[model samples]
Target: MHIAAQAYGRTSKTGLPTRELEATLLSQSAARLAAARDRRADDFALVVEALEENRKLWSLLVRASSAPESELPDALKQNVAKLGAFIFQKTIDLIENAEPEGFTALAEINRNIAAGLRGIPADA
Candidate 1:
């Protein structure tokens, strides 16, 4: 299955929306988690699968945020790095104590970030 090609919407010749990749990734992760939860059949590795994809996403953000040439403000980069670190630690925690409860926050975070990426102004 070609997930990247089919899962997310097609990219225009000009370019995708800012943070579209992150949004698409989060959308897929959310769907995966939902499907895993909905499964009547055994879902032996769902936690690992969902968390791993999310972990990779956050890792990419951390790397991008902290890059020396990154145009993002220092404070924003620091904040993102902190959140990335928290996500990393939480990934381990969820692995050790796997449950659906831990999944909500991660999904919400992704959704919220994706919302921001869509150019919605956040409330102060």
Candidate 2:
């Protein structure tokens, strides 16, 4: 079976579907933010790192969603763009202030998006 699977060009064991990868990445990012918030007084640098990573991911998402060939609906693209903008602004604010409170909004955004990608039903 393993040989047949390999011959059939099965994806590498470490490879994940696009949606799963996004959700996993988002989860990891949220966890980083939580950790940063928890350790702000002892090691604030971790907060900066977490925020920076989140910023990069959101930037990529914005660009991908904005692509002309993207299959996402216009409404979804608009929403993603708006969220990306907010993420950008919030990240900047966090960088300047380095407050643990700022992580809440960012983490929530990531968590919700990840849940959506995972096909988890949203709250009514």
TM-score of every model versus the real structure: 0.76, 0.83
TM-score of 2: 0.83
Cα lDDT, model 2, residue 5: 26
All candidates: CA RMSD (Å): 4.1, 7.2
Error of 1 at 55 (Å): 0.4
Query: Least accurate stretch of 10 residues (summed lDDT) in model 2?
Result: 1-10
For model 1, the run of ten residues with the poorest summed lDDT: 1-10
Q: Write the per-residue lDDT of candidate 2 for residues 11-95, one digit (tens) a residue.
A: 3565667667667777878888888878877886898888888888787778878999999999999999999999999998987
lDDT tens digits, residue span 7-87, model 1: 334556537653777677767776765565454136648767777777877777788779988999999999899988888
